[model samples]
Target: MAWSADKSYFFMLAKLLTYSIFGIDARPVEVEVDISPASMPKTILVGLAEAAVKESTHRIERALVNSGYTRPVDRIVINLSPADFPKEASSFDLPIALGVLAASGQLETSLFSEYSAVGELALDGVVRKVRGALSMALQARANGKKGLIVPVENSREAAVVDGIDVIPVGSLAEAVGFYTGVLPIDPVPFSWDDAVEEHGTYPFDYSDVKGQEMAKRAVTVAAAGRHHLLMIGSPGTGKTLLAQRLGTILPPLSAEESLETTRIYSAVGRLEEGESLLLQRPFRSPHHTISQAGLVGGGSIPTPGEISLAHHGILFLDELPEFNRNTLEVMRQPLEESRVTISRAVGSVTFPASLMLVSAMNPCPCGYRGDPKRQCHCSPMQIERYLSKISGPLLDRIDIHIEVPPVPFRELSARTEGTRSETMREQVIVAREAQRERFGKDGSLVNGTMAPQQIRKYCKLSKEAESLLKAAMEEMGLSARAHDKILRVSRTIADLDQAEFIDVPHLTEAINYRTLDRSSWTQ
Candidate 1:
């Protein structure tokens, strides 16, 4: 190869647009490649790239050679623009490889100016799937790019975003051919309405539970208002069974809510292959041993955690007291704010965590304090210690507290089913519609998340209801927080009944939900 400083050398620089994911957002990056004459061939990757990204140079080179493309033998310098901030992930490999080919004058194409590419290259020239392709597609569309070229495995998720074409390529050769006009690939077809309607159904339902009708009703109220719920029962009491079916009784996810929730899942690589959008409400049941970072969302790069994964859905924590106390304590902020901000040395990132928290716990260390059939083996002090694992402030954040008792043989063996999830969901949807009318069409505000001022404005109690609540507050020694929670729960119950004002029946039901606050619970 011959190079002249004035002729060929001046044309050896190429720049292609790409994106890096930060938090749940996509940040633009320019992959700039420059080929200059050198005594010995070498390649340098200059940017604040983490080890995962820096390791892509070797992979991309092998992919280029295996794909029948030559690696530039000159001094090749690749820079990811805006080098101040850190970048991670192997998704940058495709764009960098294409930039090198274009800079070396081996591939001729004008698609670099119109499309953004994101995929990891395999050693055999196959383009592997990458995380955050949906986010990257959104960013590319926002930047006015024509389309986004992604791996075939990630095309469905990226195609979920409209207004921009999502070209699915299987191999590096296919991508090169499409860019060079040698191959034509159509954009993956997406029907937003049809996809959402087809995927909104859940497999579990409340009707599957044979007994515990009171717990079922309380769970319905919790879903109607997006309230956090806690159920205490002994082993094999249907607590876990009820929690799993909560999503079926909640409102089906709307389009905007589904997109917001799906983005978090896409950013964390949680989306299953071929799954386009998450139409059904998410139900995340994390193990009790999860750390604070795993629960909230944190890492060197700040990926979304389980709470964010459960956004616009339910987060069920089974065996609640078994979780580390500190790990559970960290949820206080996210529970109140509906978002968690994880600050690191690089910067701070906030992940949306608007979710209904459903938790189950035993009444005592022996798991039989309240069971009539089972004998209670734990001492009074041990019972108190077990219950004390859950802090009062955290308890205050939850809106509903109910006892789940063991199902008798008669109820379990009977063929008759309890209330169905479809019926409960219809009531929930009606209540949610009333809430939408009160709090605008966005549906961001619900009874469970009302502010102090909003509670005063919307939760107007009837005279009889007011009297009932006053008596219960004085007798139960309820905190001010618990007082507000009672009003919110009462408001939701009234909504379920399609009543304009909170009445005595609604207030009474709400007051009964504060079971743990009673003075004689530990005794």
Candidate 2:
């Protein structure tokens, strides 16, 4: 028999469903296999398969033989449909092998219609776990798949997605048995409320720090407003400690936010084994030596970077001045847009980066520029040159700039518990509730991300507060952006105070946050 373009001939070809990951998304691919007796006995894999995908044939052959299935000797042609798109990952091994069995008349083709499978096959028929199981499960549900066949290790990750059965298979033999109705594997069980209650709590707290009440207060304001914060202080002034506890004071992650954050972590293979949903907010602190691509997400395939992993969470850049200037500058766009878009020659990928940027740095090169106890050894020119590494534009984008002075010996030795995270979180929840009512229940709009028009509409100021802002703007030589920032921060402060309008005290606190940029150290 010869191959023809006739529609009726398509019925003889065996096709199974699978998926390929494309920038944190799972795109459906049909594994279409055809065995032609007219051609030589060789297997040909098409549809732009990458090296990893192309190399799976040998593994699949051994897996099939070990799983008690015959390896097809006829001229086998496997075409991953949507032929123009590039396909990667060894997850194609299972689906291609199954398609081969069906096309060779060893298995019923109709059984594959109910499920879409993704897994890597070992030589002895074991099925290995692959990345992006959560995204694949979501896509499978969207496409009306009855279930998704995944490795046992990925069962929990994929099962978190509702409305689809996740069939956990430990080996190629088990997968075949389940599809053939000879074996039954139940969908993994998940209780959303139970998972949240178990993993939602943070181990650290604000009270864990000995002192620095002022820093704690400033951090509360920043968290309440979702504002970027920059803490300047001497070494060991508890900058890192303050930054680490910021998450404990933040509101817990909503279900939607958890799914979004989990998808990024899943796509990057960062999820721990057997972990289903990420209940707590993510806290990503990339080292200062990270590259621009590593910070914002870029590759030939354009995977999600540190910022994307920190979606709806915190991105702490400790020792901020040590980071490359270009790498730090790359954050300007994502910070403004709440998303990072990486454009590759193949395509463009946009990743969510709606996160709180918390960073820490020493005041100067010697790490004691403003310390009362330590003698300053660095020359003024050296201090000036060191501070210049952080450009003015970047500084202006940060909403709150506060100095974290060293804790006094008396304060450190005090047995009293400092401010607790629970107390600050109550304040943050109240302030966030106010923003929700003001911005509507959409949960996307906050004071820190307010547009100019929104600021004009919502930020009402008292006459005295207006006068104070004008004087500060003049004395500090603030830019138009800085002016809007003051208004936003003022609006947040007023919310924290439960005040309806911005008053003198609120405006004064907001104005003081901007003073570090105008400090004499820069002069």
TM-score of each: 0.97, 0.96
Stretches of candidate 2 above 4 Å error? 1-12, 519-521
Tell me the spans in candidate 1 whose CA falls farther than 4 Å from its real position.
Answer: 1-11
For model 2, the local distance difference test gives 0.89
| Error at 250, model 1, angstroms | 1.1
Best by TM-score: 1
Q: How far is 390's C-alpha from truth in model 1 (Å)?
A: 0.7
Tens digit per residue, CA lDDT, model 2, 1-523: 2332332232147888999998999999999988886567898999999899999988999889988887765688989998877888888998998888777666664568889999999999899999899999999999999999999999988999989999999998888888888888899888988887777778899998989998998999999999999999999999999989888989888889999999999998898776788888898999999999999999888899999999999999998999999999999989999999988877889999999999999988989887999988989888888888998878878999989999999999999999999999999999999999998866788899999899999999999999988988787877778889989999999999999999999999887787565645476
TM-score of 2: 0.96
Model 2, position 227: C-alpha lDDT score: 97
As for candidate 1, its clashing pairs are none
Cα lDDT tens digits for candidate 1, 299-360 = 98799888999999889999999999999999999999999998888889999999999999
How far off is residue 362 in model 2, in Å?
0.6
